[model samples]
Target chain A: MAQKQINGTTIDVNDEGYMTNHSQWNKVIAATIAEEEGITLTPAHWRVLDFIDHDFQEKGVVPGMRRMNKVGGIPTKDLYELFPNGPIKKAAKISGYPKPASCV
Target chain B: MTGSQPISKVSIVVSRGSLEGIYPGLIMANGARMEGIEANLFFTFFGLYGVLKNYNDKIRVATVGNPAMRVPSAKGLPMPTLLGAIPGMSAIATWMMNKEMEKIDIPPIPEFLEMIHDAGAGIYACKATVDMFHLTKDDFIPQMDKVLTVGEFYEQSAGGQIIFT
Candidate 1:
């Protein structure tokens, strides 16, 4: 797929409205969460997608790394290991949450 | 733009310095709710003390080793631990933080937690942090939904963006 840079953040909108850069970690987070919950998905991508969707329903926003760690059973300390670019920002982008202005 | 869909969810992670670090998570969670977003706060390490019922009001601003204090606002600040030993320091700090927040119309921590909860934001205390501090479930504030380990929180956050404040 072709990629374009928008204000330094990559924007890739597919037919399903999915943003590509965030998809990988989203999948990992989702799978971990699903495995923990005893829920199974035939397609790997479904795990992360559904997990984020469920979390949104429960909390009304994409959760950060610590919450993800809580929900996915991943260790917070291991976040940097999971996402080289800083877990919070990377995972958040994939989770469909914009960075808070104060963060910048 | 994502087609005018409201910001429906946000997740914040709290693990750092002192009351200042913890307060932002609470403030953001509440702020998100006000913006029609559901928010969640995950408190770990030093951040856990903020949500601990016994320690909530007992939290003291960190005067030492605080990068924030190196700036103009914190020049000549007294030591927080030392000040904690002194009477009224917590009240003074609370008053100062409240005063500053009030100027911006942000409510206090207790009020913020209330708002966040009412908006469906979940607040959890990090079990590892609790264990490290030798604290029990009863030590946490009433706002807490549960005591969770890091792995447990991850299960909850799953596909959501997870942040560490």
Candidate 2:
């Protein structure tokens, strides 16, 4: 486990820098995390992040990319364009969700 | 950026038409997207079956000359390649593989493509293969991004890891 200080607030993160505590996630923290990934927060990005957060709270699992496109209504191409390197995991991390069990 | 090396992107080349060969590329490309890596799949040669509208769903496991085909329940017993040459053997193998995949929730080829596309993986067909086969743009699934030449694929995949599946 690791710790990251964002906006002067400390949060626990996994070794890969994904925030381990979902309660510590906020828009400010998400923005800081996105900045670390070289991304500036945008409405589209927030849309995916919000969807992931809400879905995780309800389902206890981050939605897969297929579900993200179908349910979140964000197109697959748009996700890649927004997240760049890795969409699902990056979105999960930004939303303060644990890494998906299926991702490696 | 967090003191960890990032996999910026990955390009997978699918050059086989058999169900077994094609799935590896599809699964890997989808996996890359899931991990937040940019993924591109280039279909060339017989691999175009994966993108062809009519054949994508009809791909079968290649049993003939495939020494690695195993009877799943037989537990490591290899199916003789000679027996695979019999009529309807390929279809049987394909059916068994599809059934096994369904047990684990893997979707059919068409749905799989839709899933991967929705996951933000780029699917491209080989321009030369399309031309050689007289395939038009409309011959591919709607999710296919483009028919790219080998050079164009290399250009787009610059600085990214390339995998031949």
Per-model DockQ against the true two-chain complex:
0.02, 0.38
lDDT of 2 at B136: 94
- List the candidate 2 regions with Cα displacement exceeding 4 Å: A23-28, A38-47, A54-60, A71-74, B1-9, B33-39, B73-76, B82-89, B99-107, B114-122, B145-161
Q: Assign candidate 1 its CAPRI class.
A: incorrect
Per-residue lDDT for A1-104 in model 2, tens only?
Answer: 78888888999998899888877889899898988988898998889998998888888888876667667888877887898767777888888898877632
lDDT by residue for model 1 (A1-104), tens:
64534434455544433344444334444344334334443443344445555776687666544344457554434443343323444444445444422320
lDDT at B163, model 2: 95
Over 4 Å off, model 1: A1-104, B1-7, B67-94
